[model samples]
Every structure is written in C-alpha cells, then in structure tokens.
Target: MNKLSDEKPNTSGVLSAAARDARMTFGDKAKDQLKEAIEIVNATAKGLGISVGSTATAMLDIHSVAFGSGSISLHDETGIPLRGMGTGSKRLLTAGLHKEASKSKSIALIDEIETGLEPHRIVRFLKSLGSKDAEPTMQVFATSHSPIALQELSFNQVFIVRHDKPGGKTSVLAAPSDAQGALRATSSSFLAKSVLVCEGKTEIGFVRGIDLFRVEVRDKESVDAAGVSLLDCDGGSETRPFERAASFQALGYRVAVFIDNDRPIPEAEATAFVERGGALFHWAEGQSIEDAIICSATGSIVLAILEAAERLNPDDFDLLDSKIKSASGGKLNFEDAKSFAEMDCLSSEQKAWIAKAAGGKKGWFKDIGRMEALAREVVGPRFEDFDEPFKKVLKSIIMWATR
Candidate 1:
C-alpha cells in the first residue's frame, strides 16, 4: 500500500512489471481475440427477443488488471475492482482469463455454464472458453442445461450423463450425430424430460394445438407442463422421424414418434426402436393424418372443415376439385369444391374422396396453420364424437403427454 501510494514508486520495479503485464495481457491477443469473441456475443445478443440495453456491448467490458497480493483491488480502473463487476461479467471475464491460461496447456472445469448469464451471453461465453475452436488449446469439461449452450455446440462435443437409482449406476453416453439436427432446430427439447418426434410441421402443429385444447377446453394438463416437447422432422423421409427418435433414445431421452401409417417403416428398424424404449404412435392401417381425421370426424364436422377451407383459402387449397373428382371416379363432380360442402352430409364415399384429396401435396389442411386450426378450433371441441380408432390413437397421445 505504501509503495503504491507514491506517484513513481520504486518497489522492485513492480509498477513497471505490472504495466508490462497489463499490456501483455490485454494488448494485441486480447484485442484480436476479444474482438472476434465479442462479435459472436454481439451477434447472438442481437436477437435476445428482449430489450436489454441500447446495445449488447454497452453494459459489457474488459478492463486491464494488475495482480496484487493483499490488495482488494486488481483492476487498473480507479475505484472499480473485480468484485464490482456483475456476476455475468465476472464469469465471462473468468472464461477469457482461462482462455489465455489455456495457451499454457491448463485444464479447466465450469459447472452450470449458464448460471449468472443470459441465453445470448451463454453463447458468447462459450466462444470465449474455446468452444468455437475446432480443438481447444486446453481440455475443458463443462456441464450446462442451457438450450443456447446446447445449440451452439455439436453433438460430438456433448455427452448425456444419467444416474439410475435402481442400480445406482452412472452412465455417460455420447450424443448421436443425427440428434444434432433436432438440437439445432429445437434446442430447448434437450432439456425436456420427454421428446415427441413428429413426422413434420403438421404433427407438431397438431400437438401444439391439442395441448392448447386440453388446457383451455378439456381442463387437462398441457403437454409442455408434462415435460413433453414436440419436435418436427420436416417430412425428411419414410424413416426420418424414426431414425431421429432412435437417436434420441440413444441419448437417454424418453423418445416417441407420431407418424403416418401410409408408409410402413422397416420392421427391423421399428423393432429396434421399440426395444430401445421408443414409443411409436401412428394413424390406423394405411391411413394418413388427413384420412384418420376425416374418417373419425362426423359428417357435420367434416362439413365445417370444408367450409373453413373454402372461406379461408378458396383459390389455392380449393384446387382439390380434380383430385376429389379423380378419387370419386367422376361420380361426384363437385365443381370448384365450393359446392361440395353445401349438402347436409357427405356419404362415406365423399368423405373418403375428400380425405384422399386432402392428402395430396397441396392439401388444404397439410400446412401447420390449417392443421393447428383444425385441431384447436374444429375437431378438438367435439372430442367425444370421434370414431373408436381415431379416439384410441388420440387418447394414447393424451395419456403419454399427461403421464
């Protein structure tokens, strides 16, 4: 203290050495590295979806410091010390220091990397900790439950650790590469207790709409409240949803898949997935979602759906005239589809033709918005009126979600 009190203290060249260390520490390397790392921080922080400040960097900084023994203050800035910084800033600054130390082949451990940091900040903090590098300069073992952290990292860099209470066994399994696609798209599901892998946007929307329905009308618990996250496979392939769900099973995620029964998955793959504790949910024999809904729905409900389709998208979605006409063998020439729903009730043949037509590439209810509305506003209200086969599958889904 007495030595630092002097304007030009000559305490064994400590001030000069400290100044030199500060320049060495926060000089070129920090400038370049911090510049690159801060760019990531700025980019991720840009879309936090919340108003944090005037800018991402406004509330953030890196100050040069001098190591001082017995002194509470190490930062060169007057009256501001390490303790004065926010917890998130201190954690980030620690990562930066560890990054520099890693050049010396140091080892580091950071538990709960998301603690004291926002989602966007977690991303940049990982960057500072050498996570963005192909290979880290030093070995770092980190544990995080943050979805952003999982999103920023590849499957190869992640491991799922589980402890089974029955046997008191601890297992650490490396995440499969296929799971990375789901991780990138729905990162938050990695933190979910159960994952429902849907075949495409239609299923995802259906699940979301059903959850909303159960919560608002049915007076039941939500799927989200039950720790079930719905994932979209984007209609990848015949086995796409199953393959991804199998990957999740490998990661020890309680996995389930909702798919169309029109295409049969390979028996061997299906058996293996089931053996791995994956739950499979699909429409009845040779039935797609559209077919199942139409088959189970009453004539009036089907009429309502058609009316909504005509009212909402009469031009594009109503182009199903040729499809319906072709399916009906020209027996029911429902021109323009505008006149189809004017009747009191459609026959079984008409219903089948409508369902088949709706399953086409440009089907009316094939899109997420239309499917969501179908589940939430239309069919969900008359849940008790669906046929036994459709009700069975739908009830199974409800049971799994609420369980």
Candidate 2:
C-alpha cells in the first residue's frame, strides 16, 4: 500500500486544537460532534468515487479531536452506540463510520490512496467507490505505484503525467493520449466509438495486445494511429460481442463484428452477422483465433513479441517450438517449446537454442511482466501517454493481417 502524507496540514496547531477539543468531549455531545464530522468529510469527498485509507483515517482522527476523546463514538439508526462502548468500542466506532460511508453516495478522492492499507482493504475501497448507488457524477482518482490501484482502474483510467517542453515552454501535462479526451473516448465507447465485435477474451486480448504493441513500435506519422477501443463481448453466448455491438448500435453507436471461422456454426453465423451491417473476419478450416494470430505473425504477433522482448531479455521467450509441437500433439520434432511460431519452421538445434534462451518453465515470451516491460521501453519517453498511438498501431495490424 502507498503511504500518503497529509496535504501539508495547512496549520498543524489548528488541527491539533480541533483534535483536542473533540477528544475532550464525551457521551451525547461527543456522539453528535463525531456524527457531524463524519457527514462533513463524506460531503467533502463528494464527486470523487474513490477513497484511500489515509482519507478515511484522517477523517476519523479529526472526528476524534472534535469529540475531544480517544475515539469518536458513532451511533446507529437506533440512537445507540454499537455494543454500548468500552474495550471493543473503538472497533465498533470505526465500523459505524464505515457503514455510513458504504451507504453514502459521495465520491472519494484519496491522496496516495494505497497508503497503509492491505490488498483486501484496497479492493473494498474500489468496490465502495463503484457501488451500485454511487452517483453517476462520482469518480475516483488517486496516485500510486501499487499494482492493486492499477488493477482497480480500467487501462484507460490509469493516467501518466509527464514534464515536457514544446515551443520553448516547459509544463506538466497528461501525455498526449493520456488526456481525459482519450479516456472518455475509450470509456464511453459503447455509445461513442465503433464496436468491433470478437468472440472470446483471447481474441479480444490478442487484438488489444497487438494494438498496444503497434502503438509502441510505430510513430505518430504512421498509418492507422491510436485511440481504438476493444470491448470483450465475453464469448458467443448471450453476452457475445455481436450481441453487444447490436445493442450499442440500437442505442446509436457505430458497431462492427469480427468472428472466427470455426466449423459450421461460427462461419455460417458470421456471414449472417456481416449481412446485418457487421464486419467479419473468419479463421480458416480448423483454425481458431489463436491460429489467426500465428498467420498474421508478420504484421501482428512478431512486432508485439519483439516489443516485449526489447523491454526485457528477448532470449527468455522461446515458446514457438513447444506451442507448435503441442499444437501438433507431439508429432513434430522440434527442440524447444519456446520458439517464435512466426520464424518459419526451425531445425532441432534452433528449437533447442530457443528453449535454452526462454530459460525457465514459464517462458519469458509468455510473461505479462515481460510484455509490459517491453511496452514501456518501446513506447519510450512518450509511453507515459500511450492511448492514441496504441490504438492506431492496433488497427493497422488488424487491417494488415486480415487484408
């Protein structure tokens, strides 16, 4: 968890005095004071959907001071402090405030939100911010290096601030694609952008993965620039991308569909989808989207893999041989399971070399860490602001591969 310090404490003495007064109060007077304090803090955090432990703790501390006591006693709707005070009273007091926050519609903005909180608490914080009753205008924004915080936000909401000089002026600004425009563009895609429907997560992952790679490899002047959004339809079942596209289109969105050519059902169904104003991409006989990825290696997979490799030790991911051999059910005799499938069939020695380079059983090429590291490196100094460029590259790869 990230440790967040107080916001320079406008006046420590004033805050300390406030705390003293609150701490000295007791009983009915104390309860009333703390309740009002809790309400004030909740109101202050309004419009920001997320809150960190520091914000919560700080507010509680202030309440403690306001009541002039060791702890602020909170009452439930029954007008009784939970469990009737003493020993477990502090804990009950904390719980009471939590219950109130949970029920409140105010958005939370915690500075250094991860500070002093465990993973579970952080997740809870995000959940509270994302509550069903959370006001539509409420949204959370926080700064932290914790993976948990990153996980809490969608890829689009993770903002990167950088310092740059253009036209002799140095300023701090959200990177080009990192701006609110890109975020809103991607976030509200179901209503705004074109929806390219695909079958499964891997398909969605591959497209998004490839697009992010292109954003890193190519420059802005290149064809088909970034800002494209990928939304997973969660398979061809009821919530499939096609269904999502249709729904979004009905609500006034320009939606398109892309599906695999798996046997009778997907192929036949895809044709009908295209006829209904959707776009289609079919995998060849017996080929799934993963295979399509291999087929489009030249324009798609290789670049992404290369980008990943560049970020770390490229020598780490030789899964080509094993994947192919596995795909062939051990019929093919290749040395390593870690070779690049795009590298045209290789000799046993080359495969062995790949396996050797791939090193551990988890193969570097398949590691998400390796991929992200490579993405950060290839995307370079400009990577901090990665949205626009990535979308462009992804679209080009799809267009090039499918073409």
Candidate 3:
C-alpha cells in the first residue's frame, strides 16, 4: 500500500530509490534489466499522455539513473516540465497516481478535491477514486466547497459541518437523499447551524434588516451570532422552498421557511412538513412581506418606508401617489393610513412597486451591508412597533434558530 498526495513529488529521488532497490534484488543483471524496464515504462507513460524522464543510463557511483533528456523531468501535455505544469494538471496527475496505488484496504483522505480542477472533470475524478468492479476496494474521504462536487454526490454521501457561535460547538449533518438537487443548488446553507429558507431577495433583505436592528438598537444578538443562515430561493417557486426546507430538515437542522401567503402550498406537503416538526411562517392571506409591513407598522414606520422609497427612486413618487389614491379611493391623508387593509387593496404590481421603492434589487437592500445599516436607522428602538404579522414571523424564525 502507498499514500499519494496532490503535492508535487520528488521524481528524481523516487526513481533513484527504486533503482537502488532493484539492484539489491536482481544483483548482477540489475543494471541492464532496470534500464530496459525504465525505457518500457517511459514509453508506455508517454503513449498514455503522462510525462516521465525518458532515459535510464546507469550512474552507479551516485546510485542514480541518468535520463536521455539530460535532466529528470515529467513533461506536461505540451511537453513542458512538471515543475511548470498548471495546478489543474498537477492535481489530475496526483489523483491518477493515488487511484493506481490504492488497494482493497486503502483509505484516502483528500482536502478540497475541487481545487484547481474544472467543474466538468470533477465527476470523472470522483468516479476514479473507487469502483465496484475493481480489485482495489478504495474508500475515499474528500472535502469540497463547490456545488459542482455536490451535484456528483448523493445526499447521504455528503455531510454538512455547522458551527455554533453561542456555545462554540460544531456538528456534522448528513444530507437527505430526497433533497440532493436543492442541496446542490444552495450548497452554502450546509455551513449554517440553522437555515432560513426565504422566498426571495425581499424577504432576505427584511430578515437581515431585522437581525441588524436587534443587534444595534435592541442590544440583542444578531442572527449570524446565533449561527442562522438566510438562503434566498430566487423567489417562492411552487416547490423550491419546500424542497429546500425538506433538505435542511433531513440534515437535522432547525429549518424555518418564510414565504408570502399569496402563493398556496400543497396540503399534503404542508401536513408532512409540520409532521416532521418544521416551522412555516407566512404573511397574511393575499399579502406579501411588503404589504404586511405597510399595513401593520405604526405611522412612523410607514413614514420611514415612504421616506426610504423617495430617496431610492425620486421619479416613482407620482406613480406611487396615484396607486395609493386609486387604492384608497381618494386623496392621500394621514387619517386614511390606519391599517394595511384600510390603506388600499394592493395588487401584485403595487406590492412589487412598493418593494422596489423601499429598496428592492437596486435600492438599499441591493447590498446586504447597506441594508443592515438602513435597517438600523429605520427599525430604531421601537422594534416591537413593527407590524405584528412581520414581528410574529421574525420571532418564529429567531426562536427556531436559537434553539
């Protein structure tokens, strides 16, 4: 059995040692036999596109074999020395050597298998590490930070390592077979102790904002300190959120989902999720996070949102005013802004417009750091004054994360 590393090998010393060992075994005929064997090996290696020093002239005094090429060198694809080979080529060669050297009882440990390797080649590299039809039953353990690698492996073969900040602890969770695709799509979530599978960028921004507010204004721990990760699912696709949540749950993570009530979830799926002890947080019926915020927040918070919107997009004010007037059925007045329901019946377009105005893709929420800063200012000390529904949803997420 032999151990091979991706690190560059000392080719000259390795070949010299092999030559010395052959001399001890074969005695008088060793030199001729060793030279012949070297020529054959070099030719075969070259034919297979592998680089090897081509000559084996005897140098018994120094106990070394001289190469016909003058210096011992492993040539690359274009015939450059191994010393000049790129990282990918080096890694590929190292992996090949390890696979060839492995035996039935061998255990191979690799770090960052995706390093310097193209995404397309990762699958082939993994397959070569072991095979059911081969005599050498090799067992391999590898670490990777690439989603491409995850796509090549099943959930059961992948493990999530999560670090807990509060208690300073770490734990590993195995991925569930069913959520392989979702896990691969958002592989970074596996690094968090708790996961918040958000519907979209808006929800992600809102939660991050609240987490900032809690830390700066309320003097409470932030979500990051609690080891909670927020995963944006692009948007609340019919099955994306559920699939992601299920994948996290399968890994023994305390998973919570935050979505708008505008989209309906299948009853069977919802029941199964609850039965599995997953927490689901949704906005009010037919409402989104934007709608709930505007409807449930106090007069000051609503005013702040409007102010933020005006700063974000000055030209959209007239359009917003017209929409508000149409929804309110009259001129905008302080008295009419009592509740979300009373303010206006918001359409999806209106919700999107308001969200954009208050800092959607191009606004303060565009940069997570900026969003956290804005949240600190907008949220202020009156954290409890935030809309009840939004507050409740956030509370549920925080509770699950802390637990």
lDDT of 1 by residue, 1-403 (tens): 4555536647757855766555445444544545564444434333322222332231112233443433222232232334566778777866765666455677779899898898788887888777778778867799988889999998988888889999999999998888888778888888888999898888887777777888898688899888998888888678778887877788888988899888876678778888888888999888889889887777667777777666556686437567777777877644533354455366676878888877768777777887888788877887788898898898898898788
What overall lDDT goes with each candidate model? 0.73, 0.44, 0.63
**Best-to-worst ranking by TM-score:** 1, 3, 2
Residue by residue across 149-184, what tens digits does model 2's lDDT show?
555555445554433446554443232322232223
**TM-score against native, each model:** 0.75, 0.38, 0.60
Q: Model 3, 30-91: lDDT tens per residue?
A: 35755664454445444334444453223223233553433333332333445455565566
TM-score result, candidate 1: 0.75
Q: Is candidate 1 or candidate 2 better by lDDT?
A: 1
State each model's C-alpha RMSD to the native: 8.9, 15.6, 11.4
Residue 222 lDDT (model 2): 19
- Which residue runs of candidate 2 sit more than 4 Å off their true CA positions? 1-192, 221-227, 234-239, 265-272, 293-330, 336-403
Better candidate number, 1 or 3, judged by lDDT: 1
What is the Cα-based lDDT of residue 207 in candidate 1? 77
lDDT of 2: 0.44
Write the number of the candidate with greater TM-score, choosing between 1 and 3: 1
